[model samples]
Target chain A: MSSERGRGGKARNWLRLFSRKSPPTAPAKGKRDATPDAKEARAAREARRAQANAKKASRPAKTMLATPAADGRHRICVIGSSHMVAYKLAADETTIDPRLFVHFQGLAGREFAAIEADADGIFVDYEKLLLSPRHLRPMWDPLTDAIAYDAFDSFVVVGTLRTSHILKAFYEWRTTGHFSRAYIEAGVEMLIKRDPGVNLGQAIHQASGKPVVTLAAPLTAIAVDVGDQAAMDEAYRETKAAIEKGFHARGLTTVFQPDETVLDASSTKEIYARASQTLAGVEHEDEERAHMNAAFGKLVLPDILAAAGAQQAETGAPRLTSA
Target chain B: MKNPYQSLPERAFWRPSVSEVEPTAISDVYRPKFPVDKSMRVVTQGSCFSQHIGRQFVTRGYQWFEAETPFTHFPAQLSRAYNYGVFSFRTGNIYTPRLLLQWLRWACGRDEAPDEAWTNREGSVDPFRPAIEPDGFASDEEMLASRNGMIARMRESLPSIDLFIFTFGLTEAWENKESGVVYPMCPGTAGGTFDPDKHVFRNYTFLECHRDMTEAVEILRSFNPAMKILFTVSPVPLTATATGEHVLTANTRSKSLLRTLAATLSEEHDFVDYFPSFEFIIQPPFKAMFYDGNLRTVTKEGVAFVMSHFFKAHGAADETDGDDAPRRRTVTEAENDDLVCEEVMLEGAAAR
Candidate 1:
């Protein structure tokens, strides 16, 4: 279903971050420094800080994601599951090249499965899209129910085959060490093949013969920031790498998570998740870490747009990049 | 006067055992030498029928040890497509005793698997397990790496296994003239080319089957002395025979030979036992009721009957029957009936 929501007006929901929950505050320092117990705690904290600094130093320098060339005009329609909420928020705040035009259209994750492709174009089946209480929210009202094949130069498919969903397989492969890397990767690919979002992207690409870029769901936040989380971080990185490789192998252009947003090796930084909300625009519970807020979305917005631009350019250059 | 024949159990008389009872109600068909319970770690190998056995063991809460497993996140359907969790390992239908011995040798480090691979427009296929990957492997190196990984798992899993169940599938195989290596199917049918000069058909004789099985069992014992063996002959008929004989006669001869070998092996080895799964389906009294319309694939009813006898013999409850059957649809009848068989591929060739 499409609606003419109109252009060039700041959306009312653009400033939704006010409802975000604040991140945990760091421990107070001045008064506790002189006490015996506080002194011991201070030494332990210093030791942990030193260890974390060493790890950060040892890690490779983060790569800056390349942006699209400002010369050519491009139209991009970003469609996907609930992760689109973050992108919507991020896109509004993003100052972009005058040549680029991007639009947002999607339902909640489960309901998004109702979107299907035919010879005409991609369209949402209203009857099949059943929304839960947590998923009830207004999606971008496009001009028509069907996304015409010729409407956009490229598409950005988001929130399909989330890395968090398949992290168990990654950990199992790491811990068991029984299967070959190729075998485990193939299994990951098979799981990716079953994702409704991935299938949709592939179908749209096949139908339109247009470039469809995919962005994996980012890792959720971890409970605690302390400890040598290098192993878990590495696992997440490796799993994300596998998912990206799998998507590329299926002929879909893939974009990695913004490296700066990732922390504790396996999760998005606390700052990005400070005011995260579910697709319903309700504030996320303290224990909830799967969905990130506007800040996280904002970080990823540029990279996704750049990917869409890369597909439009058809430069044949390798698009796989990480920070 | 008391005579030996008069004092025998009802099972010993054909009239009482066969004539008096319904085919489904036939009892006392098998008597296992040892007790099998949930605690024992059971590993299954051999033909397609053995898949049903391993699946039943896991669903019935028995310890069906999976030596090799796919990634935990792999869905059940995907794993099955890759031939994982179908058997204890990923070897796609060992089929014959010769193939069993070959796998054992490679796994035990007694011999190395040949580096030979079959190639098509898709990619390379492992000679030993051509159908293991639904899509052909990316390269020969990938195929070998996957194979070696599986063999290593087999080696690692053998030592800890408490029971080894092997089903005898076929009497015919195609062999490489030089290496004397037997393939699970005719080469060309699955992946490799069939050459008149290089690839030759082999209908393994009774002695040859026995020798191969005996060696395989010895290898298993060498790894774990306490491991027990259970043998069953698959009742599924030969889909097509390379031999000039009619397929029906070829199937009968092939099955008879395997059945005879199972009986002889079980009788000779104290650690080995035979289950009469073949007789349950093929016997005249059963009227071939266990077979589908094609009379080739075993029906779900047939698998249930065979498994019921095994579980009943072990004194374990068969939950697959009665009220619990509805809840236990994890392994659907279609999955149980759809065997990952290389031999079935020959039917396609014959159609041409």
Candidate 2:
């Protein structure tokens, strides 16, 4: 039994010699007492952290979100030229929220209806209105008084129309040897007096209180094939330029330009042309012009709607208001 | 080795006796952790996906601005072309980071004023007419100074942007001949007719793309030092590839390189981050769930998925009645098969 145990122990020792072993351990050392400087340093670091915390706590919190107004109603207003009225008239009322009240101001009713009915008659009437001193007096008076007016949470205006009309009136008066600078100045004075108590720089301030936006004009959809189309295009361009000038002068923010190119004039023309082509076989050619039979509207509507939606999202205000 | 069942110690195969322990409370799962208090102002820009970020921000009550947009009722019908100044800026889509930065500067009033002559409107003086006519600015310096004033105004109006989101789209672009400016598409596709002399094709290398991206980011950062960046690679394949390589191969190569570069850059920079939008859309499990019938365009469902994932990941998921809840519906395998076949047919038609 002793000899067997001896053989087993020898085998165990041989196995141990070939096997891997852990590293040798170091001798244990005695703990040193805490130093005064170390304690002081740690205290200082803690105090600094505490100071930072206190400073942070004392700072005013920044607002990341806007709170909705307590009153449910979100006021909005629209102000623009005749085209604006036309576009707004075409708008689907159901899409708009009931909480918002939209007030359509600017050239509407008879003035707009006449223009829609006959463009030439409307121009002639406008010329007569401008040439006659009596017609101008009533127009300027209301505008001036309304400029100081309130009761609007948001204002949507056709910048081009306002700008173009005023500029054209001023230009024709100056060139035709009819109205003096003093008269023009008087008209401008009335406009300034009527100025919506808002400027472009003040837009953000106003928007923060209640949103205000100026929309650029929509491009004309007249076919370029006609000679009058070129003239109309030029007139449209002039109108657009005038609107931009007016917006700049008033310091109002405009979302877009009314140039035909920007409005997808090519696509619009294509639609009209295609409709005309399709209607060539039918008797209702005029009906084809009135209605967009093709999906052209869909293609353009998305972009338009997207922009409008973006505007609404950005502004975060009601589209209309009523007191 | 000698005997299969020698009288070895029982300890060799003995397992520890099991003891029953009481179940822990579920409280651990609901334990509160540190809350983030810092208010981060993030600005997002890029391809269509950027709009997703903006929409999410608005929906969740986060601060964001879509500069191109203005307040209006008929948002669906708003003209995007005009909003982006595509006609005047002559830059379509503004897909690339560099152009986006440039656009931001223009929108914010940092870039020099555009030439008044370029836009011939009544009442506004054509500032560039002299150059094209009898007399104008004596030199480019004079014209630039005039333009600089407009830029200054734009700069002043810009709000301090904090975060920038960039999405990489295509590697191909066309350069102009006279002004040497880059156009988004070759002239003929959208507005400009194809002219060999005026429009030149450019297929940017990965390094070139990286350099441009880096430059754009740096420039934007210069405007706002605190601006953090999030880069995403668009998974949408090119509508058409100008590169001679097979369209599919070219798109894959382009997207892969861009994704790699974006990841590499994000790793290198502290402020820069990469979002897994590309992965989420292109992954096998998602399996073209984000694509429309055309396979190229994103469907509303796909947009919703992306938006949901984004909101969930960002911790901005709507908690109020779970407004964005998943809807459940059962469809037979036959219906699924038909849908798939229809999609395939549509995609084939679109490709042709």
Candidate 3:
């Protein structure tokens, strides 16, 4: 019950489950409802887990992951801000896209900094870099390398458009019903070298001539106390898609946050973000409300990896020859 | 017993009106036919100059009625840049009385607006309001949807308007020859390619302007039965003339016709009144100093002087509103200015 309450951000579904179950009658009005048999419930739970694991295993080997098996997997670099946490978790756990190992590069802060690059490859001191908690100071990481150009076949970049800012706009727009065309123009214009993430991604793509796939930022959750999800969902998806359209206009591939993990389209289910905030290797929960965990990555990876695979085929530039 | 000239005030004569007086202190240019209160839901539309009225109404504590409110989080700087709150709605510059009538007719469904949208290699555009969408809409459907949204808001809000201030810009316009669907700007100048067989240039005569305005008022009255309609003529001359006559000659004919019609209409209709903005700003004794180097665009001092005179007579403005006055001069304040004449888009042809 405590665990269920802890992960109850998306509690409506669990409430439905509880309502449908024909549980044994309570002893009295003051007492809690009877628990289902532990052995039976445990067996059923294991069975569901087994089915999910089998389903994940059934997918092709090229699905994106953090650590590549090195035996014949395609390797691609994943670059982002704290938003990259989910990709790392998903890659560490399950099959996301077809068999592709991610050389994930991520960091925190400096959202408006310009990119720096020279002849010896896009500048980064990989040895001094730390891994991805991002809760305290901005930590930099290259999934498993300092990275030269030829290390990966392609790259996936997240944190392009200022999703958090747009999320704030979406909430205010939804609540107030005032939509500014000028704000949209400013946001669209910001998707260039002026923005830190876009600058880095553009610089790296330009240097390597490798196809770059950007991850569209996820919609943030707003507290929903009423039945306004239908309206909010439409606004959420419409806004997200519009932002994606701007990137599409700029000649880049995009991997949008998938639909199923989206609860109310305003934000993802708690199991994906809120529940797994403190996974075994990660530190404190809720250090950032925006970052997602591996659970979300698992649900969203297929769409992302599929987009990447499609881009690779479309832009048939050799993956790594010159570098 | 006294002749009409003997009964008139000293300001009615040229010496007090223009000659030997302080240009700023000469106040008795107009008297209101009906009272205008600061509380009335006043809506403003028409030529580029009308924006000055709308902005002033807002800054001066008038209940400037706006239908198209921007989002809550939309920043003030970007909101100005995006051209929100420039008018009651984002219909861009209406430019002429006929355009206003056409919009009113379309609003009440008294007339069927042309269903076709204009397009080029870039994107689709609303022929009636080409510059409303900066880069143009993604498709005809999108353009129509957006235009329909504006129409819906207009129909919904027009009835609630207590005062409607309109400005007449020009007599010349480019429109669909078959349907008489007039555009704010001619085809090709702003968005579409010009096809001689389809599009025609129209210089509206007095009868046409009067007739259109009459019908437009009837349609508007259907929204708010007792709405007061105030009209003004833009002092800015025509940017470029479509008529083969010299631009100056064309400007004179156009302004004269509009002024004559406004005077006639004010005399005829008890509800209608004309403000002598054009007469006060550009008519001789001031040496046309109100005009910039182009001799077309009105200067900031000119706009300020005109608006000050107007508010003193008919508005409830104060010193605070006067602080941000004369927005016409600087480019920054006018960045999101919708007070543009689409005919100016034809300047290249004259240069060529």
Candidate 4:
């Protein structure tokens, strides 16, 4: 009897250790029931697992999808200085805008028309169209003509040349005691009031929230009279510094051209020798005169496209339709 | 034409559609709608290379509008550093084509010049002068009236314009929180001042960029009604980024997105076109074109190679039938002249 009592006691002890009433067991089909201590423990475990997963996903990927492999048809609109229009024509393959064939004078308007007609895309030659009596008839008011606001997909500003010119002219005028910072700021403000569409930040904010890309003008080619080599070198350095300053102030991106740098030799003679070989008899005889060439345009286009493409890839934007 | 049933050379092996899938370089596969030609008047702006394009136009006898004469007479070396008339002044930056159009409109007098403040005996009063250079009117009304007159003259000259060249430069910029002024450089760089209260850096997303660019195109078209646009992205890397990302990587990401967006938009819109200047330098087979010292910059020999290919592709082969095109211009003897330097008027204050 005593042995039987000891075995029962051992069995009872085992039950107490293992079972513990199964933590106030509830029906399997219904909600789980647990003591507060047990419930907290369960929640903690789940939270730990989630944290681990989050950590794993946060690491950067080994490779990024930046460039695309295929080529496509495009509808583009250009607005800016003479350089933008001229370069576009020199690099294009279509002749839709035959008017663009003229050299420099009407090039912006012609190119605008050609791209529009050839690609069946819209063209706004702000330099020509905005200034034209036909478009701005009765005058354009940002407060009123909302139709103008709905027309385009993008806006590109060649800020470098224009800003440089403005700055230069402002400085020259300043020297003559006519222009001041107040004048410059007022000019900027006046432009904003004239065309509500002129506010790039707002235009960007309203139009699918896209960002504006600004291009800085290139450094001027160093110019020289046939005889004064020293003066030419000094001029080149000084001008480059000034333009660089202007570009920096404007927050413009620069497409560094080959000629922007000083060549192997410092002698004005050597500089002239090198420059003459490339620019001899060009319409603009001075070396300091910087102009867009087919080669230069071709060289920079791909980089721009690549940069734009990478941004699109990151943001999950759709690729352009292939031509 | 012999036996029809005889073992034909596996016709199934070659399918016309399948053959069309041959691999091609992205640059060679896409063709711009507007062929570069002498009859086309060309305008270029944005970035340093823009000058190169302008020079090429002058060399080829194409009309390069906005070209400053007498100034062009400067030595080539100096000219590269003193480029003017290559871009517009209204927009302070040049990453997008849209800003270019807006500035153009302002310059052409299609829109009213901004109301600028000038400091005189009274201190910071609204000035009554035209915003554009070479002419300053007394009031906004006068400027607008003058702009109307200028627009008429520009319209008469419109027929001569044939091409618009725009080069994309940056993806990073700072915008004024209140005034909405977008600075080309961060406040601390160059001429701008670092005002934490006003300036904010922005690393724009691709979607935002595309929309801005697209709107720019629309605005441009509204004006010309028949203009062609050719877009190019600058290959230069970013000097800095506000995102705190690696500057190099940031540059790659920024440029890649811009390039892709430009390509996509060009494809989607008929009037829009894109050039492969980015590919001409960045991709392989063309890598040698950059200078040995700095891979970022192009060399004289590299420039020549690029120009050669460009001329060949555009059907503007050099007049000579030699192994290579003859050198167009050499550095001038008087390239270091001091009188020709671009004078900065606001040296101290402008540097703020």
Candidate 5:
């Protein structure tokens, strides 16, 4: 009998492997005449199990369905700095062009410097991206560590160049009349050369031999009394052309922020700037932060895809049509 | 009985001062007449070698005044290539005292700059400083505007300096024969044409150099009366000489004349002092160890040794943070040692 008891004790220990709570036992019969209380406890346990199973059934699997790999659409990889959060949120709410399947890969705060490119493809640290804050991670998981060069037909690089900064350079030069036009132009080139995003985009394009499009960082939402709208507009026009020429010379298509989103040469409309979100998914109303909301991204999406498609067309690739 | 010489210090005797001590360890070479503490705003200008002095002053945490500064937003390489922050102003290699006086005259509005501009397919070049812009200015107006801006900045900055360290570079220069305006280089070598009737080669005599320097100092004093002047003669020999004399003898004559004038000025003026940087490099006892393979460019070690003496005399040697001390090479040695000298173009001009 003692040997049989010892085997029973070992069986109980095996059941306690992942938990400290003892296994439940049948109520001691007739010890306290506790049949009614045992029935109540048994009913409580059954109700808790039912509730958990029901909650599990109601939750959607994987939050949303993954985009099928063989979907009949042109794939475009959208890589960028922290500003890709808007694009991801907008992509969720709005239907992207039916012809394109966009994938997002980004991290906040200059982490793009960690990315590398080679003949195989652009190597993104998938583990690092997954470990980042929720707002900085792509809503959809990247299946592979590296996005192979053949996996995408074209690329859209967001926030590589800040057009607002360039506009400021031009405005200062114009108002003060202190610097020569050539000097201002050279300064703009230096600014372009020094941006981390632009450097990465150049590397990716060179490594992959793929058509690429670069979008300017969002203009500041702060309202400014530029004193003279005409002068600011003139500076904006010249700066835009110079920046475009700079990107074109580097073999990337330049797509500026959509016009309806911005208020002036140096600022975005206050409405678009409202409800801007941080990389950690907090809504920020600060004007100086310079990030844009989902509305701005929604408007900018078509332009980005259009530029990407246009570049693909130039390279004589077959174009996909929306259903 | 002791004679007058018997009571002198060891430094006063040739045996103890020169023969006994090591060449590098030789001290008492300079005793500053006035305190040149870190608080003083110093401006340096002269020939190519003067570049090292200004840079060292800045590196040693001294207040080396820059009259015209480049845009801080740009990378230093781009700004440096455009010849900003290389000197007090963008007067590239003022190799002669006449050129220095000419720049001062323009800055003080005592004389208007000549309208002559050198133009080729590249762009319009400033005849005064032909190689100031890496590529010449886009137009004549652009070039003149830049030149005027420099002069304005110089005019505004001179009155603020606490000390002026000027190095004498060369006695040879080219000038407009009729107007007597001197150019930094012979016109044909850098930009303009070589017309015998228009431009004349001048190896300035000691009297002319002294007179021009005196007027330059007067103009500086007119701006800031309390500004102290310290003079140095560059030990760098000439790249080439236009005169019939051999390059060595020509260089010796040029250096000897400048050195004598430097000594004379220091003795005559209470506010002026001379430093023996020339003797430190060119003296026979040191054996020219400071020169590079070309025997012209000052090596990194040479510049460090020269600056060590300068800092030691001012009692600033102890004040240097190891991060910015002259011994550590933060900037590349090649980049630090190579001076932006337009005079080097004369070598290429000679080859052709």
Candidate 6:
């Protein structure tokens, strides 16, 4: 707290940042950046420059994060299930808050870690984890790096309520051919009640000392289940509405479903759900029909942007006048 | 030994009605005139004291009818704060028999409330139940729509309400002179401006209570003839009285009047039943063991005692070993229950 300037102190910089992980005891006004990406990029750039200087002086680079800047574009962090892949794709495809840089980490939806309450803010240590694809290491590093400095302005969490699950249950006849409209609706309700998104958002907000935005898994039609899509459509819409309301109640933001994501009440357009090839023309992952391609990700980018805008609006809230 | 007194049942006298029996052992105070089981679509609306009945229904597995539930996604506590799904509907505490009748009349389309809403430094409040919304409604139009939604909910739920438990908390109320209707709280307590000329304090009489309650019952039965109404007088004494009498005397008079009216109504009709919750808290032998430090607010033990007898008579309490669980201990139940009373505000102002 002494200075927001250069600190010659070295060894305990990690401890200093770790101490910032304490619960934001009082949520003060104007304490956080309204927009984050640009600031994070600048922070990373500055961090590199400082690390180079530290190397020249034979001091540990960890000292760079010791002195903090009070205001700038935020350092945004995202971590969630497979749905995060689409979010990563969407952010890349779209123009985002110029001030913000998203340091996103992708974890399968089933993984549960009490991140926010942890003294060391790293929810998962990528170095310790063993995965089928080593490529995920790059994704995990940014989240740890962001938390080490207590650098997040906001956090986005995506989870099981994803539309891929919706498409699988309601959109495809192969999986839902025997299900009645009532049964399907009930299934959707069950998924919502059990959806980990809101709880994760709550935990992240509490632990990270940052505003949290929740993204319900996006909706895409399961092309296989053409038998009766009316039920699936109703389920999807109801689930989305429920998820949004739940998030709002907990004081978290929600990314809106992209427009034209659904072709009709019962189905997602084929083009959106088709296996999306990467820029190198390679398939992304398991050949799951429920996942949307990058084109669909482009459509969903606005929702994340909207959520970012909402977070800023609240932090810089205009004192509302009652009529 | 062969005297006439010996011929009477043990339940006929206080010595057996409560004394000589453990406080928790008291039972059969609520013998239903007809069958009422767990499946009954029960509706609960009354004083703050009646919240115990609503909370018990959930633990006991009865389908306590929630006609107007907030969107399912809302966190349970926040939903409760907005007064959604906390009761059978969001009528917020119907403290008087007259207010119940007023609500019944409006619900049945026999009457229409004035296009009235209240506003103050905080925000706009619903004319009937102001504190139901924390910040008050944003606009008079919003308040009106919310009120309409509540009435519509009553209209939909009334047909299925097999049992309606209403506990009267007060006989005193402030009346709108022009409208001739009583309000739950004095205007300025939670919202609106207090005016001496516009607001007149009225202590409702036994006759008015009888007429209003009977009319409310008739209106309810007309919609669904099978609906059985149970009346319980709140044990909590008058927090403060506007009648200019000492508060202790005011408590006695208010509770006695309500008790007599309920007893008379129950005696005259098979559908109407009165439960002696008033006596269980105030009378001797028990020695107000159920009350909190205030000597007015009933404690968890008192609510449990009343409920034990109530459910046992209806043949439900036996299943519950009647453990004194503190699940119902909440900010709303303990401290926030006072929000329902205008007199509490009077006490607050006097304290200041």
Residue ranges of candidate 5 with Cα displaced over 4 Å: A1-68, A124-144, A222-231, A282-287, A310-323, B318-334
Report, for every candidate in turn, its global Cα lDDT versus the true structure: 0.74, 0.41, 0.64, 0.41, 0.73, 0.64
Q: What are the DockQ scores of the candidates, in order?
A: 0.21, 0.01, 0.07, 0.01, 0.20, 0.05
Predict model 4's lDDT versus the native: 0.41
Ten-residue stretch with the least lDDT total in model 1 chain A: A14-23
Q: Per-residue error at B231 for model 3, in Å?
A: 0.9
> Any idea what lDDT model 5 has?
0.73
Best by TM-score: 5
Candidate 5 lDDT over residue span B1-352, tens digit each = 9998999988898778877788889888888998898889998899988888887887776788776665545556555567766777778888888999999999899999987899756788899988887778888988888788888888999999989989999999998988889999998888878899999999999999999989988998999999999999999999999998999999999999999999988998888999888988988767899897689877667777777888899887544432222312245423454578988988886655
lDDT of 1 by residue, B1-352 (tens): 9999989999999989998898888898899998888889998888888877777787787888876766655666556677877788888899999999999999999999899899866788888998887777878887887788889888988999999999999899999999888899888888988898999899999999989888998999999999999999999888889889999899988999999999998899999999998899989898888887788888777888888988899897767662112212365433544677777887887755
Tens digit of lDDT per residue, candidate 3, span B38-110?
8789988888788777777766678888787654443444444445676687787887678888888888988
TM-score order, best first, reads 5, 1, 6, 3, 4, 2
lDDT tens readout by residue for model 6, A83-169: 665555555555554445455554542342222324445444322233334333332222332254266566677665755564455
Off by over 4 Å in 3: A1-196, A199-217, A223-260, A264-266, A270-323, B1-9, B35-38, B60-62, B69-90, B174-177, B191-200, B314-339
lDDT measured at residue B42 in model 1 versus the true structure, 0 to 100 = 93
- Which regions in candidate 2 have their CA more than 4 angstroms from the true location? A1-323, B1-40, B68-76, B79-81, B84-92, B97-154, B157-159, B177-179, B319-352
Residue range with the least summed lDDT across 10 consecutive positions in model 5 chain B: B321-330
Deviation of model 2 at A306, angstroms: 44
What fnat does each of the candidate structures reach? 0.38, 0.00, 0.07, 0.00, 0.21, 0.00
Compose the digit string of candidate 1's lDDT tens values, residues A1-323.
Answer: 11112334433221111111122346675653566756797689778666655654564433211122334557677887776767766655554444565667776767777776655567654334534443334544321245666667788887567676566566555654455454666677777888877888887888888888987777767644434455566677788778777777767888777778776656677666666665555676777677777777766776787777633444432132221
Q: Candidate 1: where are CA atoms >4 Å away?
A: A1-80, A91-109, A114-157, A164-193, A199-214, A220-255, A262-271, A285-288, A303-323, B321-337
TM-score, chain A, candidate 2: 0.34
Q: For candidate 3, give the docking quality class from DockQ.
A: incorrect
Give the chain B TM-score achieved by candidate 5: 0.94
Cα lDDT tens digits, model 4, B87-125, are 322211255443454455554555653543333332332
